[model samples]
Target: MVDGISFAIGRGEFCGILGPNGAGKTTTLKMLVGNAPPSAGKLWVMGFSIPAQARAMRRKIGIVPQSDNLDPDFSVVENLAVYGRYFGLSGREVRARIPELLKLAALEDKADARISQLSGGMKRRLSIVRALINRPELLILDEPTTGLDPQIRQNLWKLLRHLQKEGLTIILTTHYMDEAERLCQRIILMDHGRVLADQSPQALIRDSIESHVLEVHGSDLDHWVGEAPVPERIRCERIGESLFFYGERLDCLVASLDEWNGLNYAYRPANLEDVFLKLTGRELRDG
Candidate 1:
């Protein structure tokens, strides 16, 4: 369902694809990997035409899917060895590569441990390195840190950064705006199967949203607005019990706050999340 979208990932670039649920993010990844073929448009990966040269392209890319698909029955070493065989790697070659891969994933000490015995972070790290067994030039991660705690997510981010520094091109898809901002050199924001904005995180925030946002919360907010009207230069909206103000500068709003008591307010610079909500609307999407 990816509507006629067109963009390219340059060599060695760390790019993020961001969107809400059912924004055709997963569908787009499937097409890129050749699991789903485009009915009309053509695709070329690493200069090889897709769905036709998919077999050849497969060798050049590594994928870490949304969920862990590691073999629970196989030990860490055995799992890596088995996956290497899929790429026609020699038993000796697999043996030689296993130790270094385990070290990179920080699983060298757990080499003999069963998949079920490893912690969630350990398993995720293993999944990332497992994709590298065949030494791919490009890596695609789909919600790589979803459902993990903040500390573990940060650790994974560090690992991904290291890989990119080593010159491997990376493409990531995630619902977390902050993750995309921190890890990706560029972001492609998509919604309803079409690209909405494609730019660096800083550029997107600068171009799409106001310079500042102010949130005022309290039962008195309704009464306060009646007493003192907001300036026409600032945009204002209300959701639930809070009033939000958006503008290049919120000094007038800040100054008015002292006139009212029992009101809680937060004023800060606009961020990628602000841009996302403004462009996509605040209504929730169930799927």
Candidate 2:
């Protein structure tokens, strides 16, 4: 249902498609990868017309899906070997790439281990290397770090960054605003099958939200908000028990923070999450 949305991603650029669930982020990715056909529109990937030459385009692109779908019955090496075969890669070529991919994924030591024997992080790393068995020019990741812990997530981030430096064009789809901020050079913010904005993460935050935010916690947030100066310019809102005040200048807020002593409050710069909420609205969307 994406409509009136048009843009281009340069070679070697890392771009993210970000939005809440049902926003068509995954649908857009599916269209680019040839899994779904556009009812009507001009679209191309890697110089090949989409859905028509979709198979041809698939040959040059690699995809890592939301879930780790590695073959549980196969060992690490076996999994990669089978995936490489799907790309028409010869056994010799696949074999040659196995060691290199293993090193790239930092899974050299677990090459022969069975899928069930590996940890979650190891399995995720293997899935990524499996996607790379064909040596793709463009890589598409759908929530690559969906369920991992912080340490493993950071480790995977390092790998993706390293790959980007090696000249791989990456298209990432994630709702995690921080993930987009850290990995993408540009972001396409989507909502209800529409492209709301397309720009760098920093640029979106700068243009959409105030420079700083004051997070007020504890009781009677409504009273605190009522006691504030002008309501419109301050841009105050309440979520659960906390209150947030957004504005370009926080001098007044900071000075009042000393007087707001009994109430737990913190002031910080606005970030990508703020920009996302600002553009998409704060209402929760059902999955």
TM-scores of the models, in the order given: 0.96, 0.96
Residue-pair clashes per candidate? 0, 0
In angstroms, the error of model 2 at 42 is 1.0
Return the number of clashes found in candidate 2.
Answer: 0
Best by lDDT: 1
lDDT of 2: 0.88
Error of 1 at 240 (Å): 2.8
C-alpha RMSD for every candidate: 1.3, 1.4
Q: What is the lDDT of residue 201 in candidate 1?
A: 94
C-alpha local distance difference test of each model: 0.91, 0.88
lDDT of 1 by residue, 20-138 (tens): 88888898899898899898788888898988988889888999999999999999999999999988899999999999899999999999999999999999999999999989999
Query: How far in Å is the alpha carbon of 139 misplaced in model 1?
Result: 0.5
By summed lDDT, which 10 consecutive residues of candidate 2 come out lowest? 224-233
lDDT of 1 at 282: 85
In model 2, the clashing pairs are none
Off by over 4 Å in 1: 259-261
lDDT of 1: 0.91
